[model samples]
Target: MAWLVSTPSRKDDTGDRLFLEVAAEAARNERIRAIYLDVRAQAFANISRAFAGLMGSDAVSDEHRALAQAFMLIELGSVCARTLLNEPVQPASDRLIECLVGMPV
Candidate 1:
């Protein structure tokens, strides 16, 4: 959250946006879509693993994975809110992170 808040907002050139553009021109089963899907999946798995590690998950179990997923959704929503409002979401986000991370793992 700190990193997210500190970074200046530019148009985030995320894979989801890129995938949308490519998807417009490509069939669902096309290799390009498959590649993007894999990339997106791997990216998410990687993030979940990272969070699990941070939260001291030895095996990245389902509970840990769900916790990580929740974090991702919150992170994405906070980013979207910040972007749309063109404002800083620091103390609120910081507090939220504290409440989340401080939870029993």
Candidate 2:
């Protein structure tokens, strides 16, 4: 992964460089994988809640509904990627849950 990102053409791209660095670092640490798993779980939960809310709102237009569905699909991809990494499932932060659900923290 890092090798792909470190290609000559992409070597100067800060985002690619950062991604390579992070991937290398994560590869060396089990804790980073666990942290990523938690974050991805929270993201998936938030996206699911947002999708449900959008689907239930009568005020939302068909176009917006489609967009929301697309967003949910993207989040699902993230969830799948995290699952593939085989990170242990852990409880998500309360702050993340509250922010995602729009509930008082």
Candidate 3:
């Protein structure tokens, strides 16, 4: 999956705006919050699929599910930190990717 390595160049993060918008809406709007929760579950499923693809497995393994959940949390944190600081996700995101490679999933 492209998302596995889809970190944008720092200056070209066009997705950040929409991410912030969704984050704000989820914080205050109950309907959007529910939808966002569903979206997050879907994201986790998507990530599991991606990880399975990487492993050349047709089904997502337990290890894949664990790694996907961890990676999702890291990604969400990276986005939040970037939006709050008005900066690019950097070394932290890079570091997370590195961890993924070494992880046994």
TM-score of each: 0.57, 0.36, 0.76
> Residue 65 deviation, candidate 2, in Å?
15
In order, the Cα lDDT scores of the candidates are: 0.59, 0.43, 0.75
Per residue, candidate 2 scores C-alpha lDDT tens digits across 1-105 of 222112212213355445445656777888986776676567555544554553465354444444444544433333433344533222322223323334221
Off by over 4 Å in 2: 1-24, 57-105
Query: In the order shown, what is each candidate's alpha-carbon RMSD?
Result: 4.7, 14.9, 2.5
Candidate 1, residue 9: how far the Cα is off, in Å: 9.4
User: Which sequence of candidate numbers ranks them by TM-score, best first?
Assistant: 3, 1, 2
Candidate 2 local distance difference test against the native: 0.43
Ranking by lDDT: 3, 1, 2
Which lDDT tens digits does candidate 1 get at residues 17-59? 5534665545655877787667757866876676577677767
Steric clash pairs (candidate 3):
none
